[model samples]
Target: MVGIVKYNMAKISGKVVSVLAKRGPGSGGTYPGHIFTKIGGQESISKLASDLKIGSVLITGTNGKTTTTTLLIKLMSNDIQIRKSYENNILNSIATALLTQKGDMGIFEYGIRNLTYGIPDTVQKLIDPIGVVYTTISQEHTQVAGIKNPFEDYYKAKKLLSEGMQRGAIVTNADDPRTALIGLNKASDVNINYYGIEVDNVEDIGGEDIECPKCGQPLSYSKHFLNHRGVYTCQCGFKRPEPDVKLVNAEFNTDSWKLTIEGDLFNYTTSQNVKFNVVLSVPPFGFHNIYNTLASITAYATFTPKVENIESTVKEIFNNLDMSFIPPGRFEVVDIGGKYVGLGQGDNGDAIKINAMFMNQFVDGPLEFIYTTPDENEEEIFNDHFEVVKSMNPAHVIVVPGRKSIEKAKEYYEIIKKEYPDAEFYPLSYDEMGVRIEKLTELARDSDYDYVIMTGCGEEQAMWEEIKKKMINR
Candidate 1:
């Protein structure tokens, strides 16, 4: 009884903090939750989460968490009110949304770099989410906070997010074996709604092979959609799960993309079967976003109370969707006068490849690749990124420090110079991010090549988005 009183008081105080914090600098999205957790303790988070009548849904994975969460929020919001938070991927952010927003459901993007930084199991227990969405897992952040987080441990950390859930649904990418294995393992404990691409028109040109998550042996793939994500099978008999929601057909054009998606999944809120098929005309948002669309649609169909509104809601949201739905600093191809420059954050290998693939669509003539080198202790990322750079066959390559450590960038540049003897290197200081952004923007803008791609590793909003704004505004 006393604990209940304390929690109520904490909630009130958190709300007050949220109201006051918003009037000042910064978004203050996590401050109230930080204060509330400090005062009421971690145990209070479950009680706080219980405020949502329909419970919460958490979106997580390596690449598309923010975009998927944003789309899910839009789809769910049309059916019912939803408390949401994205870009900020922490418990405090979710807690702040719960404390400040009034809604029946909560949609939060929860990023897990590794177990050391993210308490996935604890978050699962406390949030007790009705839905947990996985947006394609890959090798990202090999080292977190100076600790070498192995792939096995990283995979385990992602699994722990949905490992303890007894109810609700697990919405995962069927094309990605890592996320598919998660669903297959949890099939008995909860509903698994898988989403993937079924069309043959979408295929990756070249990518490295990945090992089977179930067996140690290499997985055989008949088709490759994205890096490490495709239709595959293993000697251990583990293979891609049949998708409940899938892109059955797709028509990609320079101006727009037409996607025919079909879904037949169990709606958690209504405890009933729901199905829908809709063709959406969306901006040429790239192939990665196709997966994001399926993920968000599957998650929405799984949790939305208004199951009947699935098709209508999806069409209403996606058919009229714009490039603005993409999160800040994400990959986008911009037309500067007649020149085509594709720029944004491509931190990891998978992301860099995706950015390259997106940029490839716009590259007609000689393209200058303005590459950004990853920080120290990120050699693996550089190796993977280098592979993509070689594949692009750019007329020229420019290397810049995307993170701290100018020396490391130079080292990477020397390696690139071995391949392209004429490749240029810019030893820009990460401390002076503004100068770096300006240089990157200028390189893309004034380049002799009409086609330029400035992407690799960098701060998503601070560096990439700022550079994008400058190039577009100029």
Candidate 2:
């Protein structure tokens, strides 16, 4: 077994994986991981993870794990030998652990299905994480998971890391009721910290809120950030917990926002707390990323205590981070033929709604929207935000093909046409990714518009890179 493990580790290495990556698009990053696990097994993973000096951080939730982990690495990169995983699957995570030579701390996002799929067992056996973050809980992949209640099943999945952590800090999104409830239910011995944003108006926009799980009563919100996330309450006396790290008095600037943070920072290792009053200047992105940033900042403070010069430390951290840190295909902008095109990419309906809301509220111009609709099952989701989209008053609407089928795209186009009778609807055939971007660019160049907003999900996600390449060359 030892000999086999060594041979597999040698064969399915980082170098080998990089070579495979260059082969083709279908050659996914996770392929080498699958081969590594098949040959080396859990024993190999354990051996590789044991070499890390600072252990690892396991971040899990329905959304924002990737972005939050990215931010965590950025904030903590200076002090620890931290490495991050863009891929959340445990197989790829283990393969990453084996391949990277000097990663003392692993900042990895675990997929929500890891617990249900029995992958966390391998993760737990390998690096008993030093810190765990539950970003938010929402309905996702119910059909694939073969579950009826996405909220219940997914809640169980996300709670695994908190329950598994024997002696480490756990960060929860206080604005999210499910995560807040889970944090409240944790053992008293566990170190828990919460992060949330305070806002003036709380509307039930995305409509993901069901009855309060504890009280079976309607949920109330003082501020609603996104679907099923906000400062919430129930008739049975349950309410959103006060966050340890909170963002308050957010005032928007031209391309940025000024916010004040009033909280006590807790060092995960020392169990020490320090009070801080610091104002931050944050660059612009979608609203969801604000929560992501807050979650990342709180997670960072858990491990890192403030220096004597707290103001400088806070300034340094915020100065380094901005909307630029957001991953590709999310509120990404490109310049093509003297036109600014904004691309919002997401895989789910709620994400689309949030992106639309951001564009509606923050952006101004004669807007042209090229909307790539979701699958048949989720077709109506965009329509839920139709009022918001219509309020943006897009001059022209272009319908691109969806992941499910061309029919799905046409279905959405028809639906959108009925809603906005005045707006032009141009139905384009689906082709290669480059072809799609080229068509969109040509139309945007010819159109009278200030911003060409392209929103896509699933298969249309591939267009993000092609669009970027074309725009850069132009």
Candidate 3:
């Protein structure tokens, strides 16, 4: 119910708002997109996107969407006019793409929250992505997925991305049994490309209990990597698909790692001899990112045309990249007056578990844990994460209240007290940013604590900014 000229005007206004918002106080990332969605709606946005010549590439999953999207953008050839939005919001993504429309290709990270209805209603109809990458599936978004039987709801919701994908290529992780099944179910209709990490002595641990999609039977795994992801087999004849793109013979070190990526398409060996100057949330850099790296490389390889030697092609594509680049807030490490502090921003319980275990490993001595959540509904997830953090036997633990909910803070405190009676608990309350920085600074000053590790499901960016600002001043 909108005219072309009106839509254009709305888009311009949205961009202006975005620019103004960015220059002002807060991150203007999602505001412009929100304005565009509110004013123009999906119909106008879709009409505007119809002019895209190169098609779109959608990246969506529980974790690694931003990192994967960023890597994919870097791996892709420069000539492709790829439009991407860092915002995970659907409206923001649509607006950003329409405003910045260029090149033949569009790359977007569609958040998992929008999978059920957002994909079918907006992305499928608008971007009509020729290619899609699903990073991994975990039970997240409890409110959206419903409280009871949330896993099934989350799984089905995530599958909507593939179902809505334009019959081109859908790349997924082979080790992630849930997403692998989603790809297999669609293999008959779509080009399902699978990629995963292949390593020896990979134990199945700390993953959701995976069940067969076909039958409600429990799945078995020879090697479970993280959570339910591994070489899974079911009695209903569902099994993990062999990856078309695989990173084999992977090895990790304290400062560096090595990868030998092999598949039907490409055979390449790459090593991180020089530490990338950042500590990833998944430490040793091989735990989770290896999968993300393989997925990105494999997805890009498929997107690119037939190359007889994918190894050379990969080297050529990524040769110019700053290998030192770190995705913001994943596992961001900062020095606050010579004290090494790391931030592990987990998006879900599994992510929390993964990062907690890694952070526990990489720390030299006496690690301090700071935990925060933004929503009360995430208490169950918080409990799961707190259990993992507790298992790490941190030197001290700080339970910060959620953004606006003190009640949830109290609940989190109870969980900590009930589980770890003797563990040190600091229920410090900071109402202002300055107060938070001051309190955290005081804690860092203590030589007793080796390093402070902050883990938050939400409110990571705000905390990360505060910590960075403190470091800058120090």
Best by TM-score: 1
Model 2 residue-pair collision total = 2
Ten residues in a row with the worst lDDT in model 1? Answer: 20-29
Per-candidate Cα lDDT values, in order, are: 0.90, 0.66, 0.65
- Lowest-lDDT window of 10 residues in candidate 2? 22-31
How well does candidate 3 match the true structure in TM-score terms? 0.82
Q: Residue 72 in model 1: shift from native, Å?
A: 0.5
The top-ranked prediction according to lDDT is: 1
Q: Over 4 Å off in model 2, which ranges? A: 1-36, 87-90, 113-126, 141-151, 187-189, 199-210, 305-313, 333-340, 380-388, 391-395, 422-431, 459-461
Kindly provide the TM-score of model 2 when superposed on the true structure, using C-alpha atoms. Answer: 0.83
Q: State the lDDT of candidate 3 residue by residue for 123-160, as single tens digits.
A: 56666667778898886646644433366666776777
Worst 10 residues of 3 by lDDT: 271-280
Cα deviation of 147, candidate 3, in Å = 8.5
Model 2: per-residue Cα lDDT at residue 69 = 78
lDDT, candidate 2, 181-233, per-residue tens: 87787747567889888765425464466578676788986566787787788
Q: State the number of backbone clashes in model 3.
A: 6
